[model samples]
Target: MKPPTVFMGEMTNREVEAFLVDHQTVIVPTGSTEQHGPHGPLLTDVFVPQEVARRVAPRVGALVAPSINYGLSYPHVGFTGVVNLRIPTFMAVVEDVAASLATAGFTRIVFLNGHYDNTYAIAYACANAADRLPAGVRAFPINYWDGMTADEAGEFFGPTTGLHANRGETSAVMAINPDLVDLDHANAELPPFPAVTNAPAVHTAFFFSTPGSVHRASQSGTWGDAREASVAYGERYLSVVADATVRMLDDVERTFGAMPAR
Candidate 1:
């Protein structure tokens, strides 16, 4: 049988209800609208998760929610076209979305997040929403990058990866949407570590500079070399991640079924 088509923003309410009735799980792709060096498109971060959602949803009989295209990207504000939501606003959005899914009888809600900055905010939203959900309702916020192992990173990115607009991210974007990437501009630059590091800074206030200043801190907007990125390599890396996600969803579904009702 052909895989189910993901529900886009234009999907009707009746269609959404129909999918929920047939599927027990829902996947929400979250990404940021920010600069991704000079080579990758600003939408790269979002596209990775969205693509993963597109590939994985049908396998698990899950419906993909409309992608959350905007995220907390204040650190990249120095760059053009970067948009962000304050912590409070981001949390509210996550909470509202999760709560709405729970009310609609979606027992499993998986947040497929691609942006590093969204980690804590999405986690907080999931935790808070979980408390108010029905006993069987389950929600998980997961970072696509976090799902990879050190070995996987080493194999795919080697030694050059330095976070942000790095090799892995650049490769991912190229793999998913090569037409949007401008390889001629791909460059690598590593940021300097601060002498006096503050305790793990979580809020956007920690990095209030514009994208230009942020870019200035590094050799180039990119933290790792994207010159080696290839569509074939990207496909392999994506498969690894996608396989792991499928297993995790299965585990979550099984665990949810075994849990006692509230």
Candidate 2:
């Protein structure tokens, strides 16, 4: 017999409506198509979050929606194959996507994000789409890496992880598929401007950038040590993200299940 999958795209519409009989939660994977230095795939942002959403959905009795694979990646526009949407366009897409699912009766909507720029877009989309939805529905806009500790990043990435196309992301992609990366081409190149790397996990010590600043600062589009990436580190990242998502799923149900259905 074929085993069940959490991805709703693979299921028939009947199967999806059937899922609502037992589950009201759905995870929407958000990402981008942009440069990841020389080695990492353009879709690394999407693939990483997709891995966690796929791994955790069945365990949480949720379904994974089709990926929102393009985002507002203007900085990477200088690079080939970078497909970025305007900020407003991305938000509209997200709003419609969320609204469609809510219309289908899913109450707990999760936007699992991989790209940093999409942060505000997802939040704003949720707000715009919420008022029109049926009562009791809630949308969660999340950056999956927010769950990672500075210590965890230090342990796996040897003190350097996020920023862009670096060890942590490259390693995670390598674990997903070695063929997706070519380590020989990997290299490190931080932004030319001053940037602090030692803030706490959830806190920021510096402001991000001016418009087009990232493009001016990074020629290669890598902002961390990509050479340090490895398959081992990627495996750990997958496990960590999946574990964190599972725990959050529990919190969503416990905290909101008691509220009257909207």
Candidate 3:
């Protein structure tokens, strides 16, 4: 038999009401619409999390909510097609979604994040939204990549995997949708980290100082090698993402109690 439609957008209102009768957990995919080098599409951040959510939804028997496509991309502001939401705006968006889910009877709102820059914004939004959530409702924000070790991630995408438009992410996009990647034109460029101390002033100057923006640090809009990215590697990485997400969902269920009989 075919798998049931787990996407919230694909289900009817009545279907959702009925779904909530058995399932009290909802997975929200949070991502960004920004430049992902020349090889990766602008929607790379958005698509990766959504795909990962879809893969794990069935295992957890949870509904995958409509994704929050735009996120805080201030670091990539100077890049073309990069639309960065202000911190407040991004926080509001996440809070609103979590509130909506809780109001709709979801006991647990799990946000699967893909954008590295959205880390603190998501955490702050969830913490602030806790008071707004009804009793028994809680929000959990997490990144799918966090399941893997830093060394493992670096191995797949090169050492600069933490940066934007790297090999691992490009390979993931390739695995999900080969048509979106232009491997032939892919470039490898790792911007130099500032030679300053561990002081906040130096760090702020590098990221917040418009004179040394992301574009200025890396001219090709890429941070690591994408030329070596391959569909096979992407498939492996995506499988890892799916497995890791499912493991996390398992933990959530264990911590929150399976479905809660809502």
Candidate 4:
């Protein structure tokens, strides 16, 4: 039998409503256009999640929404090519998107996020939108990496695992888009941070643009070793993350039924 078609941006109105009517779950790919060390692509943050969504949407019989390629990346501004949305602006955009989908009758809206900085903002947007949505219309935001188990983490990043451009991320990108990676420039380095820090670290919208203190702290903006990254390992990691995400969505659907009639 043929696989269920995942809707893309080019889908017609009838096709969209049909998919919604048949499968209430809609997956939205969220990522950032930021620097990812010397070898990885600037869009690495978005590419992984997008690829995962593309692979899983068909299996779960869900429609794929156009990706929100920009995210909150103020911390990586100094590295160049890193574009980020202000916290408030990002929150507003997410809220508006969720509200619009809820209004259109999508009961289960799943946000498949790739960027770490957008986590808090996305969470806030989901909560705020849920409050405004009619009963049963649930908006869920998930950090893809958070779905990984400790065992999986260990498997991906043995010991040296820094937050920014870590081994797991580099490996995943290499597996997904090997051509984009410039192995010659790949370097492993981790920046030092204070023992304690508060949320939002810095409030400036463009603090990532600073050198030394910003992304340059790491020689190549890479936090972990990329030498261990392999295509096979990446495929396994992607499968595990996608499976966990599907299970989470199933749990959410069971917890919240269809939306109430207007």
Q: Write the per-residue lDDT of candidate 1 for residues 161-180, one digit (tens) a residue.
A: 65666666777777897888
- List of clashing residue pairs for candidate 4: 77-208, 77-209, 78-208, 78-209
Could you tell me the lDDT of residue 109 within candidate 3?
93
- Model 2, 247: alpha-carbon shift in Å? 2.8
- lDDT, each prediction: 0.76, 0.82, 0.84, 0.74
- Against the hidden reference, what TM-scores do the models get? 0.84, 0.88, 0.88, 0.83
Could you arrange the candidates by lDDT from highest to lowest?
3, 2, 1, 4
| Predicted candidate 3 versus true structure: per-residue lDDT over 1-262, tens digit per residue | 5345989998888888999999888999999988889889998988999999999888887899999999877878777888888889999999999999999999989899998678878999999999999997879888887766666666765435535777788999999989999988998888777566664576466766453277777888898888888889888888988887787767766867855566
Model 1, position 217: C-alpha lDDT score: 61
Write one digit per residue (lDDT tens) for candidate 4, span 17-85: 877777777788899998888778989988888888888787777777888889887777677798878
Best by lDDT: 3
Q: Which ten residues in a row have the lowest lDDT in candidate 4?
A: 203-212
Q: Which stretch of 10 consecutive residues in model 3 shows the poorest summed lDDT?
A: 154-163
Off by over 4 Å in 1: 1-4, 8-10, 157-159, 194-216, 251-262
lDDT per residue as tens, model 2, 1-262: 6567789889989889988998999999999998898898999889999988998888888899999999978766668789978888999999999889999989989999999878977998899988878887888788886666666646544324447888878888999998999899999886544444654432222223334445666788888888978999889878987887777667666777777756
Q: In model 3, what is the error at residue 180, expressed in angstroms?
A: 0.8
